[model samples]
Target: MMNLCYNMGADLWNLLRTGGSEMKLLICVLNDTDKLDELMIKLAEAGVKGATIINSTGMGRTLYNHQESALMNSLRALLDPDRDENKTIFTVVDEAQEKAFHKVMNEVVGDLARPDSGIIFTIPVDSVTGLSK
Candidate 1:
């Protein structure tokens, strides 16, 4: 189990490190796929530089809403390591240009105050190795 866990972690790290200092993960759960493309364009305008995407689904039959299903689908894709939705865009941004990154996310994503805001999140990376542009 330990070795399995290590290998899994390594694989995930390898996947993420492919981008280097420009490593920023963007998980946006939205209702409209078109909005995603629009958001991508906006990100470009905001200087996001580059991104990767992964599709996802929710597992729970019932929740506050279907958002969980979307997230669950993403988790499934992550596990399979072969499938992903173009929806979960993995954005890579350099630390020197995070301002542009946030600008992109806020400009494109819908209102978050609403109960169903379709959240967008980011995960910063400390160091990257064994990967390239």
Candidate 2:
């Protein structure tokens, strides 16, 4: 079983690294939901043809909302509970476009390094079958 798991993991890694086309899956989680529209526009301007967006909540926010601990409740109160939910966007783009994509994201999202702004990351895509232009 261990060998099988290792083999599977290795295969997946290899596939992602050597995918037919140098593709990357970019994911962005935005704390400010109002920016979604502007983000989409920026993405389009950056040459992203397709993407998916979903409403999501962070683990910390979820715990703060559901847990009954006074500490968690107090933390939530301090953090402004209304802005806990975020929008997550996923898009597949050619690896060559990474720099432009990031530039556009920064311009629209205002430096991911800042707290509570959001997070953006990328993963190599091994294969994409049904993506249309």
Candidate 3:
């Protein structure tokens, strides 16, 4: 169910093991920016360099903290009606930094990856490239 949208499509093997950073193929469900800032500050205190974010949305409901706005619902019919308010973030992150990212999410966001936290999981780019850059 992992939708890997790559800028350049090659043989399926390339997707199995991501090495280099591609344009924009991987997905990431980032936590709240405020919490993210706090997380970064903590990481900064710990000597982390930096990180980035992309304004994105997801399909499920009650799956993330940042719910889908009313406007987004009108724009796309992909949301689940019966579920709680539509909220979930989609994102991409570095594979090597996966554990650290999750640690931040768990400590800062508290259940960001939980089923009803309204935030899904961040994906790794096996070979991401050309992410609308």
Candidate 4:
């Protein structure tokens, strides 16, 4: 089972339908930037209409690159001569599409429980404007 880390309650889906707020904001921090294209393709196949990607680097990468310590800098230079920034993807999906989204994410990125894989999470969207149906 996928660990979503959030409890939307047992009647969450029903509440979403009745409350007229079935939309959820799904965010994913993709560590392996190389897999971005494949992930996008799989997400489209899984019914995600649109998503936004931001080029971002984590704190560790930032420190590794800028740290004054010669030892850490030397290690960084030796280990990762050319490192890429992570891709942070954001999308809004309805209740039904949320499951498909997670499924495809796992399929593309593998088990997130593994180290350095990636992270995916969702937040309830109360209201959305400027979005097309």
Candidate 5:
């Protein structure tokens, strides 16, 4: 069974609906910057109409930025010199398309089980507005 996370305080009755099915918010974090274009293509082919992508940095990278010390800097560099940036993609998907969405994500992003590949999850959306059909 897929792990479903509920957004607390979202009115159960106010869900976004299209074609008689509720909508879910699909969030994906990808570590590999080079794969973003391919991922977007897959999402479009899977019927995702729109999505938002934001540049993001992990907690370790944030700490590395704030701390200033020769030894610490050297250690951080050795540990993760690149401090690669990540991308967080968000989109609203119909409940009926959940399985297909997962399939496309897995196909483009590869096995999420492998560390640092990225994470894909869904949250039940109570309501949404300004979405174009």
Candidate 6:
């Protein structure tokens, strides 16, 4: 069973590293939940195979809401009072797919430069297991 698990993990790693391109773990902190459906559609259109979406809240949101201290109150002004929670999406993509992801994300979520547009970034992935093609 251990050897079988090892072989399966190796296969998954190879699948992720196909085409000699490095894999990246793309993370997007989407402030607006309204755009989630559209974003998922756009990602699928862009050939993104899979993703994991998590309901999340920023530290500022938590602190501002719970803490009544002077500093927390001051920080509250910096945060958007309207939105309390955020949706964070994670996916793995190759170099080419990363570009496609960026394009589709911008199309659905608007420019990251603008306020409330959300933040997107990527981290290098060394190996992956249990990610099926």
Question: Candidate 2 — which residues are off by over 4 angstroms?
Answer: 1-21, 67-82
Tens digits of per-residue lDDT, candidate 1, 15-131, equal: 565533545555566544556778777777766666676665433222423555768766765785432222555654565446665565566664555654356676865445532
Tell me the whole-model lDDT of each prediction, alpha carbons only.
0.57, 0.79, 0.46, 0.80, 0.77, 0.83
Tens digit per residue, CA lDDT, model 3, 1-133: 1344433445353553344433222233543444555766664454333445555444443354347676776545456432333223333444434555556557776875465443445443455444321
The candidate that achieves the highest TM-score relative to the unseen native structure = 6
Residue-wise C-alpha lDDT for candidate 2, range 1-133, written one tens digit per residue:
9999987886676556545447789888889888789878877877788789988999877885776787967887788765668998888877656677788878888988998888888998766666654
Once model 5 is optimally superposed onto the true structure by TM-score, how far is the C-alpha of residue 86 displaced, in angstroms?
0.3
Identify the superior model by lDDT, candidate 2 or candidate 5.
2
| Candidates by TM-score, descending order | 6, 4, 5, 2, 1, 3
Counted clashes in each candidate structure: 12, 0, 21, 0, 0, 0
Clashing pairs in 2: none
List TM-scores for all candidates, in order.
Answer: 0.50, 0.70, 0.38, 0.72, 0.71, 0.74
> Judged by lDDT, which candidate is best?
6
Q: How high a TM-score does candidate 4 get? A: 0.72
What ranking emerges by lDDT with the best candidate at the front?
A: 6, 4, 2, 5, 1, 3
**Model 3 Cα shift for residue 45 (angstroms):** 5.2
Candidate 2 vs candidate 4, TM-score winner: 4
Query: Alpha-carbon error at 65 in model 4, in Å?
Result: 2.6
Worst 10 residues of 6 by lDDT: 73-82
Where is model 6 more than 4 Å wrong at Cα?
1-17, 67-82
Off by over 4 Å in 3: 1-26, 43-49, 60-96, 113-133
